[model samples]
Target: MPKKWFQNWFNSPYYHILYQQRNNAEAEFFIDNLCEYLKPSAEANLLDIACGRGRHSIYLNKKGYDITGIDLSIASIQYAKQFENSHLHFYVHDMRYLFYVNYFDIALNLFTSFGYFDTDYEHVKALKNFQKALKPDGLLVLDYFNSNKVLNMLCPQMIKTVSGVDFNIHKKIENDKIIKTIEFEDQNKPYIFKEEVKAFSMGDFKLFFEQSGFEISHCFGNYNLEEFDPANSDRLIFICKKAL
Candidate 1:
């Protein structure tokens, strides 16, 4: 059997090189705003799902929270392990499987991380796993691109040169999925990878949450915590709580 696109591409060293320019400042700003709004207890336990490089976990740990970062990429987890301490830890784990049961005060699936699975059933299963990880009434913060806005403003093709590698990218929506094809040549070798994410809308997520035993507490349009506007928001951020 072939490996999933994410399992292959995300573990590749080239993936880090291509995305090396991801803005730390922006991430920090968003985290700060989220903390201000959520105001979790100082000793709260945080679970960062698909925590690439453990950036968010490390910052949250610094803020006096007990943080656990988990990702499927072994390389990413290895790099993140260097920052581990009594309050912070990293593990290579799949979101489709259960981790801790009723252990965390908050669970976060950030940065458009929820839509990669091939089936709605799988996505819902992942959400249930997240739900299981949290204590009763525990919070879950899920951040994803606003599919409506993104499909409306889809760019068909582009070339991005990062670290001297020219990545030729093509994107399209097919079969209710957003597909991105990336191609690049490095060290005289050609490589290609595809990323497919379900173009889930507010309605779709509502159903997922309902099935996963969660109730939506708040919906934000952006990292600033503005009210969600389906047609205008750049992001779809959902704050949910375990349902009684």
Candidate 2:
């Protein structure tokens, strides 16, 4: 059977090449603010879900936390392992399955990592896994795009050239989901990829979390930790705590 879209696309070398500009600075800022706000113990166990290249995991580990990063892309995990130390680790994992039970003090699903599943149940299962992996008082920081603002700012088509590869990107909203079709050519070989993310609103997320044993403690609009504005915010950052 063919691999899933994310498995194939995210594992490809071109994926990293196209998104190479995502670096540590912005992530560091977010992490710094998040850590300050949550104030987890200095030796808290942190889990970074769908941790592409373990960037956030490595950063938190350097801040004296024990961090574990997991992603579905094996290649990304291998590269991320190069930065591992006694307090940092990376593994290839799927978010819908359970890993460590009641093991982490904090679980992070950053950079809009959720909402890739085709079925709504799958997304819930992923959140259940996140909840199951955390301790009783564990915190979950989910950084996702503001669906309302994104829908308002949707672009139909665009083109980007990265490392001499011209990527033709087209986006559309269908069936309550935002889909991006990516086509590119490299060295005379053609490539095609697709990314489909559910445009989940805050209400939708609240429902999901409530059903998955979590309660929303805070909602921020962006990396600066500002208040959320449904009409204008660029991102929807949710801070959730495991419910009793």
Error of 1 at 98 (Å): 0.6
TM-score of every candidate: 0.98, 0.98
RMSD of 1: 0.8
Candidate 2 deviant stretches above 4 angstroms: none
Q: Residue 61 deviation, candidate 2, in Å?
A: 0.9
Q: Which ten contiguous residues of candidate 2 have the minimum total lDDT?
A: 15-24
C-alpha RMSD of candidate 2:
0.8
Clashing pairs in 2: none
Deviation of model 2 at 218, angstroms: 0.3
Residue 162, model 2: lDDT of: 84
For each candidate in the order shown, give its overall lDDT on alpha carbons.
0.93, 0.93
Per-residue alpha-carbon lDDT of candidate 2 for residues 161-236, written as tens digits (9 for 90 to 100): 9888899999999999899999998889899998989999999999999989999999999999999999999999
Residue-level lDDT of model 1, residues 1-244, one tens digit each, is: 9999999988998888888877777788789999998999987989999999988888888888899999999999999999999999999999999998999999998899779888999999999999999999799999999999999999999999998999999999999999999999999999999899989999999999999999999999998889999999999999999998
